[model samples]
Target chain A: MTYERPPTPGYDLGMSSSPIRKEVDGALLAFVARQRPNLLAISDELAPLMAALDALLAEGKRLRPAFCYWGWRAAGAVEEDLDGPPGERLHEGIVNAAASLELLQASALIHDDVMDSSDTRRGQPSMHRRFEALHRAQGWPGPARAFGEGTAILLGDLCLAWSGEMFETCGLDEERRRRGRAVYDLMRTEVMCGQYLDMLEGTRGEAAVDTALRVVEFKSAKYTIERPLHLGAALAGGAPEVSAALTGYGVPLGIAFQLRDDVLGVFGDPAETGKPAGDDLREGKRTVLVALTLERATPAQAAALQRRLGDPGLDRPGVDELRQIITDTGGLAACEAMIARYTGDAERVLAAAPVPEEARAALNALAVAATARRT
Target chain B: MTYERPPTPGYDLGMSSSPIRKEVDGALLAFVARQRPNLLAISDELAPLMAALDALLAEGKRLRPAFCYWGWRAAGAVEEDLDGPPGERLHEGIVNAAASLELLQASALIHDDVMDSSDTRRGQPSMHRRFEALHRAQGWPGPARAFGEGTAILLGDLCLAWSGEMFETCGLDEERRRRGRAVYDLMRTEVMCGQYLDMLEGTRGEAAVDTALRVVEFKSAKYTIERPLHLGAALAGGAPEVSAALTGYGVPLGIAFQLRDDVLGVFGDPAETGKPAGDDLREGKRTVLVALTLERATPAQAAALQRRLGDPGLDRPGVDELRQIITDTGGLAACEAMIARYTGDAERVLAAAPVPEEARAALNALAVAATARRT
Candidate 1:
């Protein structure tokens, strides 16, 4: 039974509640609601964890799930011999798989927030921050830091454990299940390795930029976009050639996504992004953009940049000065150009991929939309 | 085809390095060694994590794996029908499943140590403790605590992800594989839920002794014994009746095992247990023994005990006093009696189980040894 992406509804991006979008949303919502009872079953003893999961699940735009459905639909359309009702089972599997991705993402974000000491996420207090506030309100002894961190760590572990349960109950075929497991495993490993590289680079200083970027590619790009998309395509019975083509498209798009994210880290609005402006600066994140800036800057500029980077107490003026320095050193333009180059590469790959022309066009549009997302 | 445990060669428990035990050790060591090259294939970015995992895996006793193998053998002995060469395949599955259990335990411990602020485990520094020390040595800020918690969280996630991968690759029947997956899911959920209960009880500080005992049963017994044994038996095609029988035998044994652990926490020799003497006293862990003491103490003694509970800087004299009070109040004897009662109950359950006589006897002996071991 083949599937194809339903035709794009004639609507602008400003219309957040498009029917086509809602169709996918409705599917995911139905899946989540049905699974809600199961989640609640597990939630009985893990009420705080359940609340944290609810918050994390609420944050995503469901883009990965959408990609998975689209991939399945595109594959289904190519199977000429199958003429039957719309493949609801396939759609359900894709939705469940996609939801698992979101859960996995939540697990990572919870831990990442704790690791970065991030106070807010998706416009609300981060899990650790909320926990810290509770600790203070209860007047716990010693320090709020330990209690906050301990709760967040448990919450993250809870999410990881629940994600595994979700995957186990996904109800896919044996072969597909194994394939999905492999994809999920690789995704997890990449994110963790990427996180490790991110920490190591910050501690080891300027000597590790190249190593850090490679980590970014595997950790951020491969996990976030490349593998997930490939997993979807692979589940749709895409052959080796099709998977290779998707990888070609996915890698550059993934890189472009992270590159844009880096740009936002330095310059995005805090209100929209939901993180403090220059929060990355405060955390001293050693992104490729930052690495490039350091490499290209004059000694004085580099020293000035270094002074402001990772200073958690840095005020508005410090952030402004650092932003100005990055721009003056050509880091902003260089990053933007890199983003454009990668996006173009992704577009080129998509155009050359041997899928249906309509599917290719839809994927190209998704790549553009993803890379250009404002926040 | 039936499987049975190899006859126990009368080897000294303390110092004997018998060939049979060595063979089991060799199997595990060789499997891990062969996988070392594949471990290298894990990205260079995760080198430190891989190193940590290598060290952690080396420290485990392979106890669960041994039980799994025995469970398989015990079940095989009664099997009247077979589909394949049951010996090698069943043994391999048991070993892999067993290894996966150890990995899961390792993952849980890494996170648990961080949550409990525990500094030592298995005679060595906890993973988080090591990371925290590193953070401090590098002159990181006052809150090196987050780094420690974050690293441990990631390490646990990595272990869980890898454990799933290992299980997925285990060559087994599809139905049996699904059953195994279900067992794993339940085990993870139970542990997390149990952990939440533990934290909640500690925070509330009003948990009844019964409530504390329930937490121990769910958190330790169900997870450590019942589930692991049942998983192995199910993998070997043991009927539902067999699983029920195993659970009946496992539950009380597991509780007895934990009671012994609680006793060791307060009075174990520091050198043998690889922890400071009275470490649990310092941490104010509200074990069943402590609960018993609180119930039986005089009003003045109870007040004094409550004041010292959870005191981070609890002194040696305080530890000594609490120990004396428990003994003076007869709580120590009561606790010991409870342990003995559970051990006796475990023996009754084993006697009533429907397994082969010899296999049942062997399991009973192991249970007694496990719960009664002094360190």
Candidate 2:
């Protein structure tokens, strides 16, 4: 299903965002349309690749691009002043660059699904699962699962490569591009590194809360938010102070976003989160929330949690039991408190940052939505 | 465990290659060194990632870089007159850009190993095998195989991302960089597309000989030779005709090179090939040779070949039996004849192209070595 915003209070930006979302979506569609011929040139059979990518790209909230667009606006591009050629060009560049983030995010999600063996994404079959079903339907030889996984890996690599290509071709001047490229390059590296750490932590078992937070910082805070804002600011030729301020605002808010995601993973409605609730528990995610739960749980509870967590077959009843234990032990409450604190910090930074009022207000609304939404 | 040139007559490019190889290796080391701190900032545990990448980077023959460098030379860059500041800078840029190809190749090889489920690469345990061993050593949770495969996937991604970063930072002027970037972008997309086709072909059983050759053309010919030459020519501001000439010379030679590889996979000595003899048979690679045998084999022979191919446990006798069928069916001879035809075509193109004498000599030598070497 496409990303439909839930009717949650205090989350709306109070602006009809359809046009802006349309522009972002339009950029992605055009880019993929450009790739269709090349993919067909390889083989007509490869056309399904473009379709699969289109499906994956269709459902994103464009959250990264929103942060990027707002960050660019905050860095001094006037909302209603993009009428001159120079302003228009800059605006277009911002939109295209922001759109590139969605492609990058697609790459990450596709690969992440393969790594996690996820069966679904965006409320549809994950890329691998989709391919697996194709293989089975066609009675293809070899292991269907391996073919699906391998194809997904290549597709992800293609998206990752195109992310850089799209950003480079976004029509930014050399100076602005160079600045953005630094962030872009480092962001890709750091995110991969963060993912490696996340994978590593999963194997080590019962990591310290601090280590889990570090994973969150790199994997979520920096990748999903801080770097996107920095990329936008850099593209806009924002002052160093502006970048610093954006980082200050982005990091805390990103942390809150991830913290809320952790909460949603355990307790949010499946319909709202677009994921099976308690997935983090089932997948044995070494999240800060789980770490906190371990730290706070009694010996018996901790043993029980350890026994049930990471059990792939853990059912709905088991999920409820785990949830009850987490809440009873105040693990959920502590996680909620941390989310509130980070949200407060983000709001404080946004207010102090020398950003334009229009962007500030939108960003404030986004922060509320990101942290407080059921999804 | 390292790529070593095979002995061949009349194929030597005079002057010891140690200096050239060192420069390419140095470029990779410096680039990775620059990324080390950024990686560590994500987590000190990422140190293993750096080490793994370095090891994989260390052993390659740098064949693609050599092709790229010689291709640049073929585009009319003077050999001994690169003393002026401008020339020196261009030379540095060429070397760095050529080195970037090696990184891309590294990414391809690592990912290829994972997809093929190969146990070894360049005589050592493949990246996934190394990681699997590490997982076992650490007594890490989760399936060791999955952890290993997942880590290899991410490492391949990091290398792929870094390839672009290094290419962009190779210090070419914007115009030249833009020219090269076009080829670079298409090359990446096409190669991944080719990889997908190759993987797809593996599952479709015995496809037509033409289909298998199409896979070869994209997966190896264009990617390994033609595009690299075009990229080098582009970086040098070579005329359109230079690109045309390079393509004329590159495509046929690349095909021959891949044909030689197919032969080596089946018949070459293990020590010389640095891969197990009959590795291709065990992997059930859908090469042109396999296609040819399938086309020509009697019913019983075809059944035997189909049954033995892709069997992971196919032993030496099984390999010998398959080899006998291929030889009897004229598959091996036909493949050799095609290789000879392409080699002839490449030599003819080199003879007629307007590329200068020094580069022509090197290109002739490389073509000979590339197509005729046992390894």
Candidate 3:
């Protein structure tokens, strides 16, 4: 398996992330190292999975944790105001708490790639593909594909378990953890349900715009943003109102962020996106953009779009035709307009939010970087 | 799509199970039903997954929880002595905590089936096959196998999550849940790492007895028996010595239990075993039995054994031949001897255990049931 990969995402975020990155990476690295001996103590044969996880962790966007951290600040936590060892402990604790999300994200990405049958992730061979290659190279008995997928599934399960373990043991107080765990539980269930529904949507070529939008809502809006924000607020011992306000801002911004990703999946440069152009179209994902295009296309155009959308063998010409059809049908315009609208909705929520002044500014900047990221 | 299944596998416990089964099943059903509306709220497309999970839960042996419950009792919990409301709460809470193991077991079984590429489970289509059939029935647009595996992965993930969730929310006090969580987390990592190592064993036709036994120690001995017992002890606020004592009893009993399963996999009646006869041979599991057989076999017999071990097309004659060779080379006898030795070791531990009188009786019966079961 080639270990080569593009620069990890988040370097391009329009923020000074060097310190935050170090702390998050430290927490992630430490927690992962702690779990390693448990697996390796059983057999050194399990080392490959640890390596794969480390690589995936390195490439994570760290966006959810970023939102979670700012949500902590939004709940009236000014890091500079609290000075002492306990305060430092709180800082380290929250960083570790936020870092748990990265572990969860890595888990989702591994399993999601298998579900999508995508061979690569973030410019590297995907987790299952890596296992598949290892199996073939080792001349292992049985079907290499099954071995690959099976190991990937197991590794993903480990990450998911680790995510929760890290969150619970992040040195947070009992009360804070109790509150945060509710949000954590809800977030996990939402993603599981959303992913299953979204997979179903891929099979339904004629799925409606509402259906596609709901998948985005469950998979992206809540999972990517709302729940993370709520977790941070809860961990900070914020009252119900703080969680409610954050949700208002997080949901729409998350929708816009996902829309941006959908756009990049179709149109962005491979270097910028770390995925090949039109990857979503190849996966036959019934995104809101595709639903809009199907709604507006002529009968013949719609039929052609459906035929080519999920064809794994679709060539450059087919992608170009689909892109052109999507543009001519005004689906691209509608999607862009919706992103603008959702971003505006999020901005309105931020304007009236009870966030502390510095946190308000940080959240505003994050919304921009989130919805407008090129990668 | 077909929901017919074998009678759930706990009826022949060689003890009265009527009341215990009701409480455990009630806890499991309630917890699962509680989580269902959240998924259905996203879309009813998730209902099939729910149904699949329900069917799986129905068929689980519930043996882990039984071990755990007695572990609690072994630590001085007496149901009859606690007669008040608080006592009732403790009873219900422990039951719920015990029930969580079934969910975790369900998760492992689903993914294990996918990994093993097994078709039927408990006289019905395996979880992945159920989804594959659903895809074919619905004429879904993708590889049915991929879709099936993907959905099963997600559903299994849900069960894993729910298992932890149930444990945390089992209405036990903070001290109990906190201690229990550590065991739960360790149990998860052990099974994951162990399962991966065991899967690798399937590929290595020449894996030795020590290697195979190590897999059993991690995958079965610890995961199936020791950890669950530890979780119960910890939750009961047992002291360190109590935990250590239980471990002495648990580990060897668990090894014997797994060896029994290995024997049944090769020799038991399909109806009683809930698996096809000689199934382990077809799967090419490098069990201690196989390893021991190789250790004793002549060069020609070993080569013949390797050639036919993992061929999926092995018919009755091929299975019979392999069985004959295993017996000739003393593999089966060696395995039986090992099982008897482990069981004896466990019985000695129990005899010296500081268990309550009634719990001592129950624990002995469970050990017998576990290692001597036909199914």
Compute each candidate's TM-score over C-alphas: 0.88, 0.95, 0.94
Report the C-alpha lDDT of model 3 over A267-318, residue by residue, as the tens digit.
7778867787788888887888888888899999999998888888877788
Error of 2 at B65 (Å): 1.3
Q: Which prediction has the highest TM-score against the true structure?
A: 2
lDDT of 2 by residue, A190-307 (tens): 8888898888889778558898888888889988889988888887778999899888989999888898888888897878667887888888887888888888999999998889
Model 1 clash pairs are A2-A76, A3-A73, A3-A76, A3-A77, A4-A73, B2-B76, B2-B77, B3-B73, B3-B76, B3-B77
> What TM value does model 1 have?
0.88
For model 1, the stretches where C-alpha displacement exceeds 4 angstroms are A1-45, A69-88, A135-144, A207-209, B1-45, B66-88, B133-146, B315-318
lDDT of 3: 0.83
Pairs of residues at least 3 apart in sequence or in different chains that clash in candidate 2: none
Return the lDDT, model 1, position B113.
88
* Candidate 2 C-alpha lDDT tens digits along B36-80: 998886677888888888888888667788778877878877655
Alpha-carbon deviation at B327 in model 1, angstroms = 2.3
Query: What tens digits encode model 1's per-residue C-alpha lDDT throughout B1-375?
Result: 222222331111211232323444554455546545643574544555666767777775455654554466455533333234653464455556667777778888898888788889878889988777777887854356666667788888887776676666666666777877777777776776777667666765753789888788778888877877777777777778878878887888878778887888888777777777778877777788889888899998888888887777877888788788878887788889988988888788778876777567557656755665655
Q: How many clashes show up in model 2?
A: 0
How does residue B220 of candidate 2 score in lDDT?
95
Best to worst by TM-score, what's the order? 2, 3, 1
**Residue-wise lDDT of candidate 1 within A257-298, one digit each (tens)?**
888788788898886677889888888888888887887899
A-chain TM-score, model 2:
0.95
